[model samples]
Target: MGEVLSIKSILGQEEPEHMNDSMSEVDDDSRPPEKCPHCGKALKYKKFAIGHFTFGSHLEKCDCSGAEAEREREMREKERLQQEEEARKRMKRIEELFRQSRLGLRFREKTFENYKIMPHNKKAFQTTLEYARNFAKYKEKGEGIFITGDYGTGKTHLAAAITNYLLGKYTPVIMGNVTKLLGNIKRTYDDSQYTETEILKELYTVDLLVIDDLGKEKPTAWVEEKLYTVINERYENYRPIVVTSNLELEEIEQRLENCGGAIVSRIIEMCMGVKIKGPDFRKQKLEKGRDV
Candidate 1:
């Protein structure tokens, strides 16, 4: 007959005859691993000793969506970093362009914001400002402007302001007194360092040009031809030219008589003449100095 099992033996207070077989079976290394409830994926399991085991679920392969969510989050972070890098590159490129341009070196101090606009020359001020603001349209239209007035009437100031505005926008601008320009050209003839063709090419190719003191130079035959060449090239290319002068239309026409109205016609055709009238700013400064 089978041995009767006591209460102590059943509760493990004493070992039974079949205890070795049961313990060996419980710690079998070939036992099946646990599986995830949601995805049926095999879970991690380990047997340390007889009847001793550990189990852990890999939630990445389960219905928790942990792995997918993490992947998406990483992708979004990568995109954000990429966008910031691109913005930094664009800003650097713009700064480099502005530095390379060196377009407004001379007129750095002249800008629309600091211009002194008065009631007497309000029309001229407004018109000039409008032209500068709408420079793109004027450039496309190949439009130009002629600013005429008495000496020290803020003609140079307005013209320089336009130059500064264009340069700030990265547009090419060249400005200088007509007499000085001629002088430079003449110097190039004496010194082989600079060439007339090179100088003229720069003046003609600029996006906008400001020719100040137009009638200040004596309009000789050679001078007229030089002026004609500069004006005619710009006119043919449909480039804009801004002129500031203390002379009236009639005076300019008479001064450049050697061109037989050719130069006058070209100036008139390309530019809209606007007369600026006001008390001379230089005189005002002088009077103020005297009072002081």
Candidate 2:
């Protein structure tokens, strides 16, 4: 009878220990069984353990066409969001550049679509339109258009149109009357918000620079020096510039002969001349009004 009792006690202790081990295994199986919604397949679960201790279980990926497609969709969505963010940043930079460009409010409305196409100015119009459209190619080569024609012949209009078009494409461009631009720079000699070097640096480094009524500025020694500095620097750096002038190349050269003809030489080298000939639109309007 004592031997039987001893065997019973040993069996009882062994059974509880075995049951505890089984309970621990059950506790480690914490991950619920899941199915792939796309393929209706049972999702696998992986157990993570360190030595004798079990940490947890995690759902494993499903190997199916549906799962691959879902992953691709998610990846595409992520990529699209990243692209949108980049585009927003680009647009913001462009806006800041436009504000700094100093493009006048009067020229803001000038655009290729609103340009009137007349037989006399048709070629000039087409040439400028092509230049604006293929601006990237021209900019890469550091080539620009030199629009020379009579006063009020739409020269400045074409230059402004180019500025408006490029601005819309998020390109950094500066368009201003030559006299006004130079005057602004000169004002820096007195108390001003910007120094001469800072203003000149912006002019030199911009993507595109448009000088309206180029030869209309008073031909002074100081004026020629400033013009030469801007032109020579841009020429050296392979940056493009668009110029409009009421005077022809020869006249422009004579006007700035004090600069030793370097300005005209650089302009000729870097620009393709587009000559426009037509009755002055402003004059025509005034005459028509008088007749009416």
Return the top candidate by lDDT. 2
The per-candidate count of clashes, in order, stands at 0, 0
For each of the candidates, the C-alpha root-mean-square deviation to the true structure, in angstroms, is 20.7, 13.4
Those runs of model 1 whose alpha carbons end farther than 4 Å from true positions after fitting are: 1-107
Clashing pairs in 1: none
**Model 2: per-residue Cα lDDT over 197-220, one tens digit each:** 877887787888999888877889
Task: Judge candidate 2 at residue 25 and give its lDDT.
Answer: 24
Backbone clashes, candidate 2 = 0
Note the Cα lDDT for every prediction shown: 0.73, 0.79
Quote model 2's TM-score.
0.70
Q: Roughly what TM-score does model 1 have, to 2 decimal places?
A: 0.63
The model with the greatest TM-score is 2
